[model samples]
Target chain A: MKKLLVLSAFAAMLASGTALADTSGKKIAFSNNYAGNSWRQAMLDSYGIVTKKAVEDKIVAAADVFTTADKEVPTQAAQVQNLILQGYDAIVINAASPDALNGAIKQACDAGIVVVSFDGIVTEPCAYRVVVDFKDMGKQEVEQMAKFQPKGGNLLEIRGLAGTSIDDAIHAGILEGVAAHPEFKIVGSVTGDWDQTTAQKAVATILPSLPDVVGIVDQGGDGYGAAQAFAAANKPRPTIIMGNRQDELKWWKEQKEKDGYKTWSASIAPGVSTLAFWVAQQVLDGRKDIPHDLLVPYLAFTQDDFEAALPKIKEGGVATHEYTQEEAIAAIKANIK
Target chain B: MTAIAPGTLPKSSPRGNAARARLLRGLLPALSLALVLIAIAWLNPRAISYFGFNLMLNLAIPIALATIAQMFVIAGNELDLSIGTFVGFVGCVTATWLRDAPLLGIAVLLGSIGAYALLGALIHLRNLPSIVVTLGMSFVWQGLAILILPKPGGKAPDWLLAIMSFKPPYVPFPIMAALIIAAVVHFGLMRTSYGVILRGSGGNAAALRRAGWSLLKTKIVLFALTGLFGVLSGMALIGITTSADANIGNGYTLLSIAGVILGGGEFVGGRVSPIGAVIGALTLALAASPLLTFMHIPPDWQVAANGAILIIVLAARVLISRRER
Candidate 1:
């Protein structure tokens, strides 16, 4: 029975391989807004690796990436228009503004182009969104902290970039978590802008005024900085939530070996750009049943599994998972219901 | 946009040399514009079409407006470091108040312009550096913008949306808007008598004072004009983007300065050309990112390439003006 099931799975794989051939002559473009940080760099790297193989395998004719020099909404909007004019079959975007790019995105939809946005997803109804449950991840951070600290006290919240949807969602989730677990009290909050340096500076500034006794909750790209701030201040260390960055994980490993420090880490994988790329390809391949919004799980690590994943992540890069076409289809299937 | 002698061209000087210098100065801006246009067309012939321009230059309208705003300050031999944030503040207002409450929005916008006039009066009376005053105002405007809209979501007014997306038959909206802006500003600040007074204040304030022109009024008017155009720029930006972010217009500060310089406007002496400034704004709008896109430059090098393009064009302008000297 096992042999028969394996033979049938092989046949199903063969069938999907033939189905992928329909998009062999089409081209897709990735329109990225910014690449100033490690997360975005890893995103582009994963996209390059995945799309290079896709092109080599003739899954698509070409997959090119275009990143705007400035992190301005209008610049990225103009880029989408250019991609439309260039006649790409589809465009995958990590947008600058969720709604500011809607004009350009609507123009793309009017021109009959498929647009799939991830990470910094757009609100345009015509576009496909591949989102990770950031709120859940935020809630999970506190839950994990509960497991380690057992007795929660004051918490320092390091927020992401100001005026971003992801930042708001994660903040809301953390607030909800604290409400449910009344022991965790958020004493102070600082805007980190999702950068290590910025987070360090912000935490350093607020540390002098706050009573942070137990743990630190933060949006990704900021954990290491908070730890650094705590170290520089010569304060007792807290159970800080990590953001799946290599440096954060590396620091966690060091602390774990020294004193058995426990924590949790989670972030939307940067390689989600590749998943967005695959979604665009699927849409271009005449898949009408795909939902407009596909929610995938965030990349996360705990004390037991984080060390194993740390070495695989590039130096100064975030932990990431490049999505294959099968995994993308599975994600789509899961979202369908 | 024709080459017009900017201001009192030294009536007693070597007349031929003065005329030649003025002509070269006027032509330098157009030359830079033409070089960028030709480079774009050469890189990708497809970008020369009407649709191509509409898409490529979609954001140029606001940029040109912002440049014109900067030109007014430069014309008075002063600078506005706050215009960018001011525009962002205006954009936040347009996206929220302008859409929800029209009368309040209009009042607030006009009030802000009045505030600018007041700033001008204060700067003139106190003998404060325009640079320092405007620099401080930049933070004030940014804070106000964030207060109005903490997040990056607001709808552009329907009328604004309709006006911005309007497609004229032969010419693109951005091009049409640029021409109108250039023509109207050129007439107002170049041919009119009061415009001469304004420029004269920058050229020779003592002579203007002796001539019985109120330098205070000119400064106020210049600043109010900057406020007016900045509001328009912010509104146009939101109309195009269909939403607002508090940081949306932050880039305009440097870009506006660059546009004014690229358009052959001088830092002091009221040596500014409205038509040339408009052309310069267009040149920058095109060169900022479109040229790099057409050139297929790598993303990693695009910012550096943008700087190189700016340097090359400005260098050519300097070289041309030098030849006339």
Candidate 2:
């Protein structure tokens, strides 16, 4: 009779624990579009790093990640639908296309799930966005170029993937920046495809025809490649605006030591995914003040700053800054309606 | 050689002129290659130099190798829609296992080729469409590539990089590599006695089978050859890029098919040429980017312009080919 009474009490406790799991924490899923590039790899890695802590701290009940190879919109849409059906409390997406996943996102929204999109974002109204202002990046880069070349000269623009929204916005901002400095002449533009080898090849091909270029404005990921092209031709190194890739930083450090070269580097940190994770946690914690669209600033570093941070980055890894959980919560609170 | 009698000399007729037109039709790919070269030279005279060619054609070695691989399948009247992903899989192997552990890499790559042979046999035995089978295999290969290297971070083996970077005097490495690929494949496929049987299998499989040649063996051999060249192409690509990505060769499937067709190959016919295929690859590579970039066209329109060039060249070939009839 005593054993039976003990068993009944244990079963009641188990039932209560099960009932409390829902209110204790929320289940989250990360949907990634492509895992082919280093930047994406780093972003995904950051998610793993942050979610482990979040899970241990009871900020999230469970976290899962999925990636598609071809960046097909249909595949990602299906993935989001599966996440919703799996009863996830929130879904974080680096979307393949801006508008293709809206219907699925809306269905999730109707289910009362929180959705946050970052980097390559979705266009769904229900989804909150965490993005860096790429136009400002372009404008800032050109302004830096102007400072480097006080006596305005020809500028070669090494652009990112053609026809991408980010590419268009950055180019527009660059044009705006150039308009402010009439002395800077836009000589030519070429798509680097956001790859080092491709950028190198394109720059090498175009190098023969151009006049003396005083400065170069390029999207992040191709700065080292452009430098290599100039080196190959044995031409005087132009003042290249640096991208915050580790390889670029290493090269810049070497140049600074060897020739006292000076340059600035700036980019959207790969750790922005961590910020997205923290924001999701805050929103799930009943922080109703979070803004719909959160604009994160780009991480900018001078040559000395890069040298100081160089040791922190691993070989073959990208250069990025940390976004602490406290800072993410603070920012959201400040921006809340 | 039997000598024609002086009194029985044939008169010059329209048939002779028709024969000449057919001969010219066969030379259309070569002519088009020359035309493209001339156009490139006209746009940028310095591009015709040795250093310029080296830089311009640095990436052509892989394309040429891929075209040859596609040619092997086309010679058997079978297309490989999986060659691109197959190359990516091979590239992943080369950049990771092949660089880190040489023996295991060789075994895996050889095993992959064997798998290709089996795939060819299976398609033949089941009477499956090559297109459907290869398309299915494309996904499998891509999945395997991702499994091997989840991200784009593997380094190409040092020896392969060394070979790719070798700079010979006067002749560019790419041009030399192209010539060597063409000549070797031509000799292997066109000059050997067994090669005739291979071509015969495509032209008339029933006749070949009647003569005791195994259709299954020919199919397997053709696919294995394709696997061999695809591996070479992948390795060469990594050697140049010095890294690997799972989707690096995604564009190669259509490019290989286009190369084969543009090189005077037919969809169902046994007609194909190694030299022409390489030239076609070179032409397509030139037209794809360098030509348009040199023309000062915007990047957004370059892809469309490339299609236009291909259409115009193919149309010119068709116009000349019509005269053969």
Which residue runs of candidate 1 sit more than 4 Å off their true CA positions? Answer: A1-18, B1-21
Per-residue lDDT over B1-325 for candidate 2, one digit per residue giving the tens place of the 0 to 100 score: 1357988866777658777887776687788888888877887776787756765676678888999999988998999999989888998899899999999999999999899899889988999999999999999999999899775557788999899889998889999999999999999889998888887778888888999999999999999999999999988887866667676677688878888777877666577889889988888777664565455443234346757887887787677767766
Q: Where is model 1 chain B poorest over a 10-residue stretch in terms of lDDT?
A: B1-10
lDDT for position B169 in model 1: 98
Displacement of residue B6 (Cα, Å) in model 2 is 21
| Candidate 1 lDDT, A173-288, residue by residue in tens | 99888988999899999999989899999999999898756999999999999999999999999999999999999999999999899889999999999999999998888878
True-vs-predicted CA distance for residue A231, candidate 2, Å: 56
DockQ, prediction 2: 0.02
lDDT score for residue A100 of model 1: 80
Enumerate residue pairs that collide in model 1. Answer: none
Number of the top DockQ candidate:
1
TM-score versus the correct structure, for each prediction: 0.93, 0.52
